[model samples]
Target: MDQGGAPPVFSVTAEGDDDRVHVAVTGEVDMATADTMFQTALREPTRALTLDLRAVTFFDSAAIHAVVRLSQRFPATLTVLPSAQVRRVLEVSGLGEQDWLAGR
Candidate 1:
């Protein structure tokens, strides 16, 4: 839920086995929901993790920090598929060239 009128829709779903897990994030991902998203993504502790953020509509700095923390935790095992919105932020943050980013 955001600070505005209607509560913003936010969800984090993870699938696949411990070998490789995929997490899809949708809706607004701000300070309010970033920690939940981070925890959800770590639930499985897979050898490899792919974050599908193509459906995310809003991504704040907190969200980016969460992603960075995940990347640090997983290191070589982390991969991210960023939406246009997320990608723009990553680029601005100088993280766009990270190897963890998929589809460039």
Candidate 2:
């Protein structure tokens, strides 16, 4: 679902079994939609969560914070399919190459 914000924030549905939630995130994720992302991740009762960010075009600090927060809270295995731009941001933010950010 694309959460309408100051900018268009987009994300995908995460249907879960007992152990995973799958959300394919696209477009941009900024402050306005950061909370929504966290909420969606937390709502899942799963050990594995996949955030496919292959289609994401943009994101900011707030989005980074949300990712970190979810990493800490859920302990869900997170698969981040970041595009080059988003990956650069994550790398700069110190979360890109970490084991925690690696889903497998």
Could you say which candidate leads in TM-score? 1
- Tens-digit lDDT track for model 1 on 1-104? 45776544798999999699999998889999999999998898688899999888889999999999999888898999999999998999999999999877
Clashes of 2: 0
Q: What is each predicted model's overall lDDT from 0 to 1?
A: 0.90, 0.74
Query: Cα miss at 99, model 1 (Å)?
Result: 0.3
Best by lDDT: 1
Tens digits of per-residue lDDT for model 2, 16-44: 78887887677778887777877877676
Q: Clash pairs of candidate 2?
A: none
